[model samples]
Target: MSVNSRSDREREHFNALATDLGSVWWGSITKAGQLRLDERAKLAIRYGGLSPGKVVLEPGAGNAEFTKRLATSGATIVGVEISPNQVAIANERLIEFPKAKVVVGDINKLDFPDGTFDAIVGNAVLHHFDLITALPEMLRVLKPGGSFFFTEPNMLNPQIAVEKNIKFIGRALQNSPDETAFFRWQIDSILKRNGFSRIWVKPFDFLHPGVPDSLIPFFQKFSHFLSNIPVIKEIGGSLQIYAQR
Candidate 1:
């Protein structure tokens, strides 16, 4: 299938899953799962240097798990989710924050006006779309000097691929377009083309081979510690990038 077709199918798959599951795996679990999510959210916020009274836009907010935390920063938070069910869940999750708005929409065709937000954030979402088309929209919606922060699975991590392949084989999945090592490079190029400056990339959750889960707290912690080391930090489980328009 073409990229466009695959994207549509993936979106449909997620929408159905969101409707049936009520919430995505990211927010429905507890204990170490919640901790992993919270840690990543905190890291993104810290990296973005989010402040009070700013207008923050989160595109592709699955279940709005991070949206709730973003609201606590005293920013006016708006989340655009492609899945209506996920948007509904996000609304409930963020109902206390009157300034927060969760809308069901496509990120590639966002409805916001140009230069509308102080910061744009996305977590584990960009790889789902063709960056060539989607990234320019991300840059266009940001105000001058505004920041864009995103966290994506690190395809460069050898262990991650191995695990994904294992799951693929066990599930009889074939021809799945797993994230590639070139994703970071492609994104960096797109950011540069879109006039974003001071791009910074950091790898996080290095020690563990797979997703940060209950069975790997010690390993995750060890990896987190190693991430601070100069050389080891260059390669991690996820690649986080921050760029200013």
Candidate 2:
């Protein structure tokens, strides 16, 4: 599909989610899901090198969950989302966060000038776009030495592989028409080719948000243990991407 059509489809899909499910479509409404968001937000803030005086760009800020959390660090955050409905929800979430705001825009055609941001952070957002085309825009917006952190689906994982490759499964899972998962090396190589340095893409996150609330802590510990193992670590459900420009 052409990029324009793909973006239109993304807008439609996410607008439906914003209208029908509000912020629950991506599984952040439950207790375990909330914990997962908290962990992802913490990782992004810590590893993305966000600070009080810095300016950060958060692309595809659906519902602004991460944007709200990022704002707590005192950094100025500009959140871009393609879906107007989703942007409305995101704006609601950031009502009290004067330092952050969500606007409807395309990541591939960002409106900012070069070297405008100190860092970029995203959560499961990059895979929705064509990485080869989108990474350059990300690189263009970052100041020298600026870094980025993103958590995306791991194509190596069994469920993610199936979800990405199988049409029926992906539709049932509410995936957008053009969204796909990525291998760690795929993203690492793309970042390298785009002139990013200090790149590190590691498979991580085994705890599913659907796990029972009572079992969440146990699974969290198990995930931590599994991360330390060699081969087993490669099959985690998501990839943690950290890189500098």
Candidate 3:
């Protein structure tokens, strides 16, 4: 699909979700969902090395769910989203955060000047675009040594493999028409080709948001254990990516 068409689809897909589900568009409105969101934000902060004065870029900042967390660190946050509806919701969620703002724009063609950000961080956003076309723009906006940290769906995971590969399943699960999951190696090579350095792509996360609240404590521990097992670790539900430009 052309970039324009895919962008259109993304806008429509997310706009509808924002109108219908608010922050719940990404995860259930439950303790499990909150846990997942908390974990991702913590990792993003630690891995992205965010600080009070840092300027961070968050692409696909739907409803500002993650952006709000990033803002709490006192970093200047500029969130970019394609859907105006989602942007509006994000803006509201970030109203008290003077350091954070959400703008409607395409990530593949960011409006920022060169070296505009100290780091780029996001959750489940990259797979929505063609990295060959998107990464160059991301690399262009980052300072020479700026880092990137993201949590992306792992294609090796059984559930993700099926959901992404089967059109009906993906649609039912609310996936944007063109969005897909990724293998760690694919992202590693793409980052390298796009001139990013210090790249690291590791598979992690097995705590599903659907797990019952009663079982969460035990499941969280078990999930951590599963994520550390050598080859078995490759099938984790998410890939933690870190790279520097």
Candidate 4:
């Protein structure tokens, strides 16, 4: 299998957002954005298995917002973003961090040689393409025993469902033209087919945007509360995963 190419619409959408997250209604560091970042940090620590001296590759580094944070792990992180504009921004923003470097590259056609990295990671990125093909390409590049981890939105969530499934509504919500969320079973099947073992999946989050920061602490607890509820667990917010090649 080979890396998939980006669609023209997908390239345009991301390039525009790369100019600035604020250009998109949903990508900015609003209250919800902060919450999302916090969750990503927690997921990385608990599942990423990143450690000092390990070399990690982050595809779709997106202006390095999460990439900069990943640097805190004391790992050598090479962030490869496909959008040149976003890569420029990431380089500028990451200047202060010695452990991190951002470059413009495609996730489907990664530039590295086989087994060059200890791990491969992402955040809200895998849903952009048909993972059935992409995962094999990734496995080919990753070292034996190298891990893959990331968090992605759950399509079953009401807000996400409408935004992604409805054409006009998705545009209004700034859902990327080429992106789609995933379900647990679907993802598990994809990983298993790609030869990933020891797969771990956890669902969490319930809070949406517009919640004031002052109330975030309260709502965060409430979000986890709802995540534990039977059927509600599947539609809360995002799915966190960790798997090895």
lDDT of 4 at 225: 94
Q: Estimate, for each residue in 37-144, the C-alpha lDDT of model 4 and write its tens digit.
A: 767865675566778978888877877888878888888889887667777778888888888998877666678888888888878878875576567778878889
Q: Name the regions of candidate 3 deviating beyond 4 angstroms.
A: 24-28
Please give the RMSD to the true structure for each candidate, in Å.
3.4, 1.1, 1.1, 2.3
Candidate 3: tens digits of C-alpha lDDT, residues 179-218: 8998999999988888999999999988998888999999
Q: Per-residue error at 30 for model 2, in Å?
A: 2.1
Candidates 1 and 2, the one with greater lDDT = 2
Q: Score candidate 4 by lDDT.
A: 0.78
Model 1 spans with C-alpha error above 4 angstroms: 1-7, 26-30, 163-183, 207-217
Clashing pairs in 3: none
> Candidate 1: worst 10 consecutive residues by lDDT?
170-179
Winner by lDDT: 3
lDDT for model 2, on a 0 to 1 scale? 0.89
Task: Give every collision pair in model 4.
Answer: none
